[model samples]
Target: MGERMFPLERQKKILELLMIKKVLKLTELTEELNISIDTLRRDLNHLTKQGKIEKIYGGVKLVESKFGESTIADRLISHIEEKERIAKKCSEYIHDGDCIYLDSGSTTFQIAKYIKNKKNLTVITNSVPIVNELMNDDVELIIIGGKVRQNEQSVVAYEYLFNFNELNILKAFIGASGITIEKGISDYNLEEAITRKNMIELSKEVYVAADSTKFDKDVTIGIAPLDKIDYIITDGNIKKDFINKFKKITTSLIISE
Candidate 1:
């Protein structure tokens, strides 16, 4: 058996393990760390209190972060079909010659894919993935320059706030880390949240594109209340209760087929 570690050392190991595995069962953790259940529980409780991890049924998982929950590559593959459906549904809203804002996220990257056939559309975005997707397309592309977040492959900084005022954005399709009736739409990164809020303020119509899994959840930063959104576009897998709840808050709740 390995020598027992100090509480801080054990806790640090637990967090490191969670950073790799994302989630681990209680028994698995104890066995791997060669610690008692009670000791593991104490460590978990401390981590939970510090907001580094969250306890789930029979296991613990790291708290969500921009790319900490899962890297952008992982997120791009996750719920791919659902994201495609949501993106296709969102594309129906875009018209030729329209200027739109696509926020940085997996779903918005999918939107970039679907809008390639549009004519003379101008896309304003901070997402590197979306920019790559539409780089050769016929549409006009505008990139918001800022600090690049490596894992998320997005740019965000306070310097672009004044730049948004000059453009007339007809529609803005934003992404959310979490969505609830109360908090509305929330994101994990403060810089991203600031960019989204500016886009929402300047656009004539604001649409939030998120997957069903994002519903009824709250995250670290709140972007705007639900009333600020004109439309909520999500996959058809969303619960009826969530659909009903969101419909009451936004002007329209669009469920992709």
Candidate 2:
């Protein structure tokens, strides 16, 4: 039998376990925690009431967070200032004649506005908004061919696997729906996650540009682990604890003002 724990402690433990496993059968959870069925039920009810978990017929799974489901337009207006700060700081790493991959996201779209002045730069992207932003600029622009996802204003790069294989990206700037020490970086959409993964693998340097709100969250599909990221750029609003935690993972954590 597992040692008895307070209600809050047990509930916290249950949530932690759910975070890792995503879904857990009632018997499995009870056996793993050595808790009574009634106790587990109470915890499950509390979590369900909080909209944190969904109770299935015989198991429970975490509720999908709304951040990942939001459209690009929705995201664009939500964290305008924070996104701009992070994007401005991210743009500092770019230079003339560099081949960079910008993953499709609202933050990366903000990067397009800042990089219009760079000469001889090659910008490759799957974002329709980013393409529109940089099309008339004096830089070479390449769009990854794919099915356009209207909500995201981005391409699902499944049609251009060959092009991705041959490209040598100098630096890749990516955005995430969530970031966690355990999950590294993740997004809700599997196709987007796969696209980001390919970009990370092909790039010499990988930078994740996200606001402080992205930290300590997890989503359905994982893009890459912390070991794969070279830098994390975020706004100054990030907590000191997150700074300390991420410093140990990536080469640099740039906190933008």
Candidate 3:
């Protein structure tokens, strides 16, 4: 038989479960984890001591999560269905004659794939993948000039910052590594964070599209707070607690089917 999961892996799963259910009883956790009560007790005790969870009457709840940035391939593969749902929901906001900015995110790239047929739509992006998908489409594509950040399949630089001032964008669709009520929007890269802040300033409206997995999490760099977002489109499977929290932060909270 294969080796069993490590304590660290089990603890991570516990935190992820908390993010989904908001709360879980010890019994449910034992069943899901396939571990005995005594072993799970050790894991829970460790996580609680780390300040990662709050031990309630019968189970545990997640404190906010701190996540590291993943490679583009990792991000694209982890939650494909949820990302697609969020993308489809965000795509409904696109219209002909509108100039929009698409952040270089896998989810935002999905939006590009969905909107290929929209004639006269101006798409400004720094993402290599997004540009490759839309260059031959009916939409107007503007690729920002910057050093390519190959891991993200995007570019980041300040040399072309003035270009944004010359154009009027109707909307900006931003993606983030983590989003918390306290942190608003954030990512792991300093340069990417700078670019997102500029996009926020240049656009008349901002829409953030992220999956449920991104909720209640914070990363290394801060982008902006709730006040900057006009709308947030996410998958419907998100926890009710997250839904309520996001609703209070953004002007409109759309749950995608």
Candidate 4:
């Protein structure tokens, strides 16, 4: 949910601009930064509290400060090798101009880690963290409008499902709290579950990016039935029995090192 929201580089760009311009208007920042107003507001808030910048009503200016960055930096460091491998392998299906949906969860965010630089891709997501990951990329982004959840660092529910039927999503990369032949795919939050369900329904193909630990576990909220999944991309350490079961449900699967 961290850089998977807005990368460290983009945040640095804002600070760099303030260093040069001293005081930059919101319009200038938005225009030059190429990030949405709402997203910039959140970044500015973070920088303000970090004592790196002073937030004015319509703009911000850099401030000399020594506060260390917290909360997000180390997050991208966890499950490092596994997530990176899974992310790279799962990303093979994403073509140059594919329109896709990326779900919330650190694992799915890993998918963004690999494809943020892919040109002409259209990524539709409700995860605030995912937006952070791709904000500076050369791609079209569509953030699903909804209330942002602070802990999860994602947006969900509300009117987000309205025009999904009109979007021709080529593929959906989802994160699962649990994946079993019995309960299907699930997440810990009902709101997130519903949101992921919405994305699965909108896309032509659905792929779950899960680590080995989530294979047999079942969480609180259900996302979709087993058969809805088209591919399962995960670490090769998964149990053979679990892989056998998954084969019966999904059309294809990939186990990456």
Each model's TM-score, in the order given? 0.72, 0.72, 0.71, 0.70
Tens digit per residue, CA lDDT, model 3, 22-43: 6799999998989889989999
Pairs in clash, predicted candidate 2? none
State residue 178's C-alpha deviation in candidate 4, in Å. 0.5
Q: In what order do the candidates fall by lDDT, top score first?
A: 1, 2, 3, 4
TM for candidate 1 is 0.72
Name the lDDT value of residue 75 in candidate 2.
Answer: 68
For residues 43-77, what per-residue lDDT tens digits would candidate 1 score against the true structure? 99999999888999999987776635576655776
Candidate 3's C-alpha runs over 4 A off are 1-68, 160-162
| Cα RMSD of predicted structure 1 | 11.2
Write one digit per residue (lDDT tens) for candidate 4, span 1-257: 22344556668778655533557899998778777788778888888888878877777766543443212223344466787798899888898989999886777777887887677899998877678768888879898877887546678767544576777999999988788878788877888888888888888999998888788888778888878988888898889997787566645668996
Model 2 deviation from native, Cα RMSD in Å:
16.9
Q: Global lDDT of each model?
A: 0.86, 0.85, 0.82, 0.77
Q: Judged by lDDT relative to the true structure, which candidate is superior, 1 or 2?
A: 1
Model 4 Cα shift for residue 32 (angstroms) = 20
Candidate 2 residue-wise lDDT at 165: 79
The better candidate by TM-score, 2 or 4, is 2
Which one wins by TM-score: 1 or 4? 1
